[model samples]
Target: MSRKTDPLIVRRLRGEERVLEVGIGDRTGVAARLVDAGIDVRATDVRPVAAPEGVRFRVEDVTAVDEPDAFHRVDTVYALNCPAELHRPIRDLAAAVGATFRFTTLGYEAPSIPVERETLGGGDTPRLTLYTATTRDGTPRGSR
Candidate 1:
């Protein structure tokens, strides 16, 4: 079976070793695609839920990241349709674990942190904004 992917997510993360999907309530599309692409995908949620085969699922709350070890050395930490309220915690979590942080918003809210944005899709596909949580000691990595 072919796994459906968020083209943008898979595009950015496809070659990475491992990924942590934050707040994966019931949506499995992203995880499935990652797994299919041979990336080790682990997912977390506040509730006890299951992921598709090949994905490691755990109950985790990014807002209060307790088991930092569970995230150690992961390539990335991402969430779909994340809210502004969650931007800080997960960004902190990813930074603490030395992983790249990325997410998409629900369209009704703005990012609460400094981020590098990318526009996803073209032509017939619907456009969505993808944000990479970043630092600006200067500025985001991709920007001069």
Candidate 2:
């Protein structure tokens, strides 16, 4: 099967030292593509999977990585799942790791039937949100 996840992991990796993927899933296809494109990559998640060639696998909780300074050595970070309140934490992690580019694809919130209206900010509208952040700061400090 053709894997659609490869593009997200490879696009911004041209001149980076290495790229890290937060969720590996069945998306080894992306890892394979990254290797083919000459981008060094590491894959990490709570679960373990045999990684494809040229992709290093790390089994650790994103929130529990002890050495936050290690992140400053990478060029890119990818997070596909939208983990609610932890979004900012992930962004901080990417920054800590020295990732100049970060990309995330969050699941679209289910559309509401009536669509609640807001008196302020803006009127009721369909919302699609994806979380992506890039920063020169490669460390988790203060707030994102």
Candidate 3:
């Protein structure tokens, strides 16, 4: 199947030093595309995952007791088709790590955290709406 999550994320995150792709459940190409763009990508899921070429995979529960180490180095943290329940936790993780946090929600679920919406599509590119978390500070909510 084609990865609905692609180039847009790659497009938006250009020039980042490193990034974390959270809840990469079956949407592995998101990280893959980020990698092709020369961004360092590390993806995580609660369970183990098969990483794409040039992408690093980790088993992580963002809501777990210990923080995921990937946070320390990444400049951005994002998820695609993230469920409503995870919006806050993931955004909080990004906040704690001083990373810019963003996500796209499942169609029916309203965002549970503050966000700025962006529409990503026009022509052959599939239309996708993505949410970038807005933190309390001037920075993106997740970033310090």
Candidate 4:
């Protein structure tokens, strides 16, 4: 059986925009697929990484990035397997990188992963929901 991907993740790409994948594993299958579809992709991790050709790779921490205008008008930001506490950081990264779309994946239950409801500073922390603007078929219900 073939595993299905979340359609909202890739149905509207113009095939030539810059995309950033944060917390990407050793090999970025999504990035590869997007590149095959003609998008310019970039992969970044907290530590070292060796990226494939045609995909620019960076070694930087998503939470503490300090580069000014470091990206080339990023269209999308993918953060798979990221902890809920990291959501704000991811949001900051996307904003810093100029990403218009942000995609993230999380588990359904608590304790399965470290999803802290209260941030370290204190306040009602928002859960890392996918922003659910699109359907399973990738038809967006509203604009971002």
For residues 1-144, write the lDDT of model 2, one tens digit per residue.
123433533553555657787767666776677788888878887888888988888886777765765533576676555444445556667656555334443454321111121121113432323234522352322222
In lDDT terms, how accurate is model 2? 0.56
> Residue 112 error for model 4, in Å?
16
**Location of the lowest summed lDDT over 10 successive residues in candidate 2:** 113-122
For candidate 2, list the clashing residue pairs, or say none. 71-97, 71-98, 72-97, 72-98, 95-138, 95-139, 96-138, 96-139
lDDT digits (tens) for residues 1-144 of candidate 3:
136547777788887879998888776877877788888998889988788988888887888725645444588888888899999888878877778887888888888988888888768878888888995553467444
Point out the higher-scoring one by lDDT: 1 or 2.
1
Task: Name the lDDT value of residue 131 in candidate 2.
Answer: 35
Q: Please, what are the lDDT tens digits per residue for candidate 1 over residues 1-144?
A: 112237657877887888998888778888888899999999998998878899888887778766688644487888898989998898888887778888888778888999988887667766677888879762542222
Clashes of 2: 8
TM-score of 3: 0.87
Question: Candidate 3: which stretches are off by over 4 Å?
Answer: 1-5, 68-72, 136-139, 142-144
Q: Is candidate 2 or candidate 3 better by TM-score?
A: 3
Runs in model 2 deviating more than 4 A are 69-72, 109-131, 134-144
Residue 104 in model 1: lDDT: 89
lDDT per model, in order? Answer: 0.79, 0.56, 0.79, 0.55
